[model samples]
Each structure stands twice: as C-alpha cells, then as structure tokens.
Target: MLTAQDDLIGHQTPAPFATSGAGDARFTERYWYTAHPIDGSELLFDAGLGYYPNKDVMDAFAGLTIGRRQYNFRASRRLGGRPLETSVGPFRIEIVEGMKRHRLTLVENPSGISFSLEFEASFPSAQEKQNYRERDGLVEEDLARVSQFGRWRGWIVVDGRRFNVEPAMWWGQRDRSWGLRSEMRTDETRPPVATHRNFFWTWSMFQFETSALSIFLKERSPGKPHYLSGTEFKRESDGSVSHREVVAVEHRIDWANDPLGQTIANGDLTFQFDRGAPRQVKMHGLPTRFYLKAGMYGGLQGWTHGDDRGDYYAAHDVWNLDDPATREVARTLSDHVIKLESAGDVGFGISEYGVATGYPLYEGPQKFPAL
Candidate 1:
C-alpha cells in the first residue's frame, strides 16, 4: 500500500507512509486555516483537512459567515484509494510553496458557497513546544504544532453574492499539527467522573505592522494555569526576524451574559516582557462569528470527526446568528475575529476561548451585551 509519498526522504516508521506508529484511533494529522478582513467588515471563515490513519478516514470542512448568516460545508471519504489526495468532494488544499504559500479552493457545490484563496506567509513560522497531557493515567493529548501569520488573496462567493479578498485587507493565520489528539472522537473509553468542571483555554495569533504575537493559555482551575506561552516574532528594518519570549500574561475580560457565561464582551490582555514595559492590547469581537463545530471539531448535529460516513458523504447547512432562539441552540465553544489595538496601532486575529466551569471571571454579575 505504498504511495508516492513513500519515495520521499522523510519516513518515521519502518512501514509505508500510510502506516502510523500509534495504533490509537485518536491519532490524527490536520491542516487548519482561518482568514478575515482586517477591519472584519462582513466575512470571516475557517477551513480544515484532517487524516486519521488508524481509522482509515479523511475529511474536509469549511465554515463561512457573511453578515449574520453562517454557511457550513463538510465532506468525508474512506482513505486508502487516493493515499495522497488532498481533496474531499469539492474541498481541496494545495501547498503551493510549503510554508511560504498555499492555495485553498472549493468548487461549486449545492451549498452555493465557493472560494479560491491564496495565503502567503508574512513571517517565518513559530514552532511551539510539545503539548502533552494525561488524566487518570490516560494520555489525552500529545502533539506538536507550527503556526504562522499571513495574508489572503482571492475571492469568495456565498449563494449569489461575490466578495473580493485582497492580501492588503485580508489577514490570516494557519497551523500544521499532528499526533495523538484524542479530542476528535465522540466516544471515549475512560473512567467515569462524577463532577465535570469547566475548561478554560485560549490560543490567539495577532499580526501587527512589523511583528506578530502568538499566545497560548490553558488553566487548570480558576487561578492555576496548567500551560502558558507568549511569543513575539519581530521583523527588523533590515528584513531580519527575531523572536522574544514573554514572561507572563494577564487576562482582564468582561464576560457576556450568554448561556455558558464564557463569551468575552470586551476586554484587554496585558503581556509582560522580560525587560521592556508590559504591552496591553484592547480586544473587540467582530460581527462575524465562526465556530469549531461547523468544521466537525466538536460535532455538528452528531457528525463528529473520524466518523465513518461511508465512501463519500457531503452535507451543507445554514444558521442565522442574528436570531436569538437560533443563536442559543447553535452556540458552542467558538472562535471570534478580534480587532487588536495597542498604542493606537491596529492588528487583527482570531480568539478561541472555551469556558465551562471553575472560571473565576464568571462568578460575578455579567454584562449582557447585544449578541
């Protein structure tokens, strides 16, 4: 079952490229990309392609939001036929220049949504340290990730309307990650737990004029941080790039009166450096919202990732974010397009935050802003 990828010099296992070292059904490799306008006028979207060697499945999903309408497209197929194919139904992703550039496309489908976008890296990628976690003697997460900030150039069509995306106005961030990411599964064979507390995590990458910032935070409890990292990639005047490590970070969030009390209405994040004074950035949520469920992360209507959808399956659905009744039912742990302001300089990125319980910020009265 050797494919063309077997001819390459990179080989991790003694078997063919199709074989994975881990026999766990949770092992996965994924390509995830998100893009939005700098000002976030109306459009924000994210797409992903995932491979599960143990499960012998590959799937691709796209979620797009225009104004208050959210459109989702998903497709899946059994692996092994086209061992190296990057396309699933109408969704396709091409690595035009490895880490430098990429082309993502979705042909015309019944969903009435299509796009052909090119992403060019603005700076070298930042490789984060290995992320490993275990609970009750079970290895839950073990993975490595590389992230980059870039700009998107192309166009997107929703239904009958067309929108032009220019590199100067459209910013994006992408990450290539692989390993045993067990959260992709819907069923878990673990010990029963009586109490379920909240889980708080945030991962964001913002690009400024001359530098980009990447932040990752995971809390064990209300005030105890299990993992934290802050990195700044600075571009010098001579075109050289450098990275600096942050010493600490503080989250000052004003929570929204949502069902879960996890939404951030308005807030600021202060990042402390080793030597220079700390930097504080104001954060504002854009009008467009994109959730992970639409991409099959947390499952949409019971369609979770790695599920056996037979040889080929494609589906589409739409939701109106403006409708309060629909919003409560469709609301999940989601990502928001964020506008960043520091010292009057403007930047933008996506903020992914999930809060369940044990979060200290949600203890007091929350301000219910117009959602």
Candidate 2:
C-alpha cells in the first residue's frame, strides 16, 4: 500500500551499538493468543505498536490478521487534514531496527486466540493524539480461533484534503511468516536492531513538517502488549507547510509497574519536551481497571501470552509542546485538541492535533539531502 523508490527498510549496513551498557538482563517469556467466546461473525483486526528512541530513531508495527471466517482486508486511511485516521480493516503496522532484514506478517485468526491488550491510534489531531492506551481489546486467557486467510493494506490520505500518498506495496497471503517495517536507517549486517524485526515494539510512525507523530507498544509485567508509547512533536516551520524539522519532544510518564505509581496524580510529571512555553494540560482518563487479554512474542519485557489484566489510565493531555531535546517549546494551541470517552474498562478518544516539525532532512540517514 506504499510506493517508495527505496525499501521502507533503508539499505544500510549494520553498526555496533549499546543498550543500557553491559548488564546481565535475562528474560523469559511465553505467549498464547486465544480467541475467547468465539465470535465467527465479527471481522477482528486493526491493532499495532510504535517505537521511538530519542528523536532520531523511529519505527512502527502494523498487521492485519483475521480470527474467524475465511479472509479479510484492512487498510489505514487519514481523513480531515491528516488529523483523523480510519484503519479500514485490521492493523496497519511495520517494524524496523536498523534496517538489515525486516519481517512483515499477516494473520487470519481461526484456531483460538484471546489476549487482553491496549491499542492507540491518533486522528484529527497530531499533537495531542499521542496514541492513548486502551485497557482491553484483544487480550485475555481464553480459547480463540485462527482463520485460514487474512489480508492487510495501507491506504494513507495525507494533507487532510485528498489523496496525497503514492503507494506501491508487495503483499502475500496470510500464510507467510514475514512482517512489514519502515525505517530511516537500515543496518543490514548489525545484530539485534538490524535484524529488521522487533518482537517487542511493532507499530507505525508519521511526520508532518517539523511535527512528528509516532505510536508503538510493549507488554508490561502482567499484560502482553499492554502499554502504548507515543511521541508527539512540533517545530519551527518555514513556508509551504510540510518541509519543517521536529524541534521538540514531550516526555511524560503515563504508566508504571508500581501500583502506587499508576495514576498521573501519583506518578512523576515533568516537561522535558522543550525549552519555550511552560505549558501543561489536564487529562480526565477512564478508570484504571479492566478485564483484558494479551499475546506473547517469544521472549518479551512486559507480558506473556494471553495475558488478562488491568491498570489505570495513567495520563492524558490535550495540547502540550516541547523541543527536540525533550524541552518545552511554546504554549501554542495552533496544533491540537483532545476528547476522551469510555465504555466501562474500554477507553475512546479523539484528538485534533498537528505540529510544525523542523528536523534536517537527511539523504541517507547521515548527510543532509542537499537542496
């Protein structure tokens, strides 16, 4: 569903790196994606995760898998000035480390799959959408089905006016084991990050001018794929709207493992997103409890397979600006608005946000593309 001259996974050689210095971090994991209370009539798909490390490294994960029936189609579309998105089907996700070799997978649930999990997707607003967390959607400890065939597509409607994306993608059936990923740098020879696969953070990312909106996910101690991480950005803009750089990032702790650290009121709050305006927005999130399920991906950090759990709504804000170094920018409402809703443990939100991003455009992840 995308048309790029180069592979979404940048063609680059792997480079050595370090994660949390050298420490013995042993992790054990087990997963079971069972579909509980088998509902063969509903077309269940459309979920994913996004990851952002610092401001420069970005990647997302999306997939479309069916649970019942024979086959299905899912697409991601943005309507209303790139503010709202309609994932017209299942998950629109891709994964990327440092390129190397990324994998893409499609699913059609038929056997038995039920796992408690959280989901995040922003629409109508870029700055405030921050991909809020949904307590439970497809996470639980129960029996589920895995369909025979499943299909996924990405139909992006950028600019908020009409179709502004040129898409050309290579898609196969739901039978393959590959996964999709989009990256700015691809280290083909690297080990972990360059494997082009993220068993953990699998989601999608988008940048408009200096404004960036990235969404990803990770399972927590009790739930698999439980927490949703979002990085909303805005920057000084030149003219013409879409060629600015992302100058800031908003850093706020939404959730934590400690029950005493779950609420925004009890959690740490600091604006490390920018250096301009001293701005803060209040959030009235849904209840912190729910009944959900989760899925395990081999070895993970946050959860195990078919995990059913609950937590507080952590944090929520309408419009807040910050700088590239996680510094606060200016108090500008020129970018976003927010709304929250709930149906018991489930949460619903609509954000109308955008930002002026101004990061230097690099031609090959190193040198800036000469104008």
Candidate 3:
C-alpha cells in the first residue's frame, strides 16, 4: 500500500528536471504524445520513447494514421547521454520550457517520416496517486506519473510531403512515467507465474476546448476489481486552475472476437468525478487501426528487444490489416485510438487493452467477461 508520504517523497517540485529513483532491472522512463487535427482531418500521430536502465537501451516509435493507411517507424540503440536530454538516433525529445513545454523532433530517416512539433502545457501537470503492491514475493512499484493536456505547434512531414500544424487547431496530451513494470524482467529461465496470468489496462486522456480529462485503470486478472485513478482539469476564466479526482467509473464494452477468438473491446465508458456531474464518453474503435496486429504503431511483438547489444530490432513496414498470414503472427497487444464523445464534446485518445497469455512469464486460459 502507498501513503501520501510515499507519493511526495521522490517528487521534484517541477518535473522533467531529473529522473526518479527507479533502480531496478525493469525501471523504465517513458514518454507518450499524441496529436490530432481539429479540422476534421482523419489523420492522427502518435509517438513515444522508452528508456530502460538495466538493459542500457533506449527505443522510440512514431506513427501516422491517414484514413485506412498507417505508416510507422521504430528504432532502438544503446542508451547514453543525460536522461533529461531525450535522444535516440534520429528521434529527440527536448524539454524546451521544463515541465510546461516540450519539443519532439524526428530527423529524416531512411523510412522518410519526420516531424518537429512543440507541446505547450495548458495546465499544471497532475500526478496520479502512487501505487504499491506485492505479488509472489515481488514488490511492484509504480511510483509516479504526471499527465497534462496541451496544444501542439509545428509540422509533420510524411515521405517528404509537409503538413503545417497550427497551435489553435492542433491539440494533444502527454504523460511522463517512471516505474517498475513486471515485463521488465531479464531472467528467461523462470517458469510462468500465476500472477502473470491475465491483465486489463486502459490509459486515456481527452482534450476539450476548456478542460481535459484522463482515466487510468489496471486489472491484474479476470474476476478482479480494477485499480482506477484519474484527474479532470478545468481552466477558469480568471486564469486560475481547478482540478479534481475522478471517483467512479463504469464501462460498457462491446466485445468482438477476432478471427483468432481473442476478445476485443469497442464501446463506451462513463466517469464520475468527486465534485461534478458524471460524464459519459463513447469510443468508436477504428476497424482498420487495431493495435494487436500493428507492427510498432501499437503492437507488442515488434516493440521489445533483449538487453544484449546485438539483440535489438526495429520495425520497418506496416502490417497488412486484412492478411491472415501477417495478422496471426503480429497479434499480441491491443492498441486503439478511439473516437470519443461526451455531451457535445468530441476528441480522441488510446484504449490500450491486452491480456498476456501463453508465454514464459504467463500461460493458460484466463476468463474475462464477454460482451
């Protein structure tokens, strides 16, 4: 269990100033950024990087989804340089104005996708409650996470074609998290553990005109209640900020089975805050953009690598969504950018759902509610 002191202990007054005290094989410092056009363009961009200390490696991925077609680029290399200076090969994430602003840039690579975008925070960063749990004699420490909504300014070039990004018309959200994840283990000889059976996870941040909402949930196994945490930030007319914790949540998942019989969720979610009226949000899962089979765009298979210097691999091609030959081998994780609606508000974010089974660390049939 985590207390208030636990949350305050390692927190720096202003974030992005230094890394956290995550000293383990699985310690990971990661960044996730997403941007979309406000003019009803059917294009979206998602980029992220993860730094693993024990492995001494850093990897990055960036993708663009235009209508039904998606282009992705991924790279991994030996970790070096200052932690605050996020750089891995052609991808660089710099904190231009500390925690309130950042710039993510991708230099032109052989794959031909590049971008130079700036993110200006709309409100002060909100921290999620600290999480501490122990399972099978292994203590899981998810120390701290900070999320913020902001506007993007810059341009993204796809295959040498340039598209301008205006701050007023481009909105996005970003979060920085440093913690110990179960999957960061380096030992391969250990048998599968019951604690690794099945998991359900969702992390979403919705950006609206005057406010932003974020929701996070994690369930370790089937038939277990989930651990939920979230925050809502509203900009006041006087240039002040008001925020609150989201207290209650309920999900109405429209489940569908893929050709492989794996369950997938496509539906609506509702959240209740501690002080405000409940808000209902609807999610429309894009049939063509499912992450289970996506290469580095969102898939789990192509994004990971061994700690050994020679074992790193990067994704180069988009997985054909319709081909069974490619889909079967690419299926592993669920990543979707669902269209969200609540009242008259409309936005987009990710619904990352996955159930890990039949691996060296997780095996066997796990039951979850079917739609």
TM-score of each: 0.91, 0.24, 0.76
Q: Cα RMSD (Å) between model 3 and the true structure?
A: 7.0
lDDT of 1 by residue, 1-371 (tens): 67777888988877877777457788888999998987648788789999987788999988788887889899999886585888898999999999999999999999898999999999888887788999899898898888899999998988888889899999999999888885633212232312334556678888888888988887756446778777888899889998877667877777666563246677788888767777888888765678666777655566778888999999988877767755544544466888889888888888877554555555542222111
lDDT of 2 by residue, 135-243 (tens): 2672122211111111123332111211111111111111111111122122212223212111222222332222333343333221233444444444444422222
The better-scoring model by TM-score among 2 and 3 is 3
Q: Which order, best to worst by TM-score?
A: 1, 3, 2
C-alpha lDDT of all candidate models, in order: 0.78, 0.21, 0.65
The list of candidate 2 runs beyond 4 A from truth reads 1-108, 111-232, 235-274, 287-293, 297-371
lDDT of 3 at 200: 55
For this target, which candidate reaches the highest lDDT against the unseen true structure?
1
Quality of model 3 by C-alpha lDDT: 0.65
User: Once superposed on the true structure, which residue ranges of model 1 sit more than 4 Å away at CA?
Assistant: 184-198, 221-223, 258-261, 274-276, 364-371
Error of 1 at 202 (Å): 0.8
Query: Against the correct fold, how does model 3 do in TM-score?
Result: 0.76
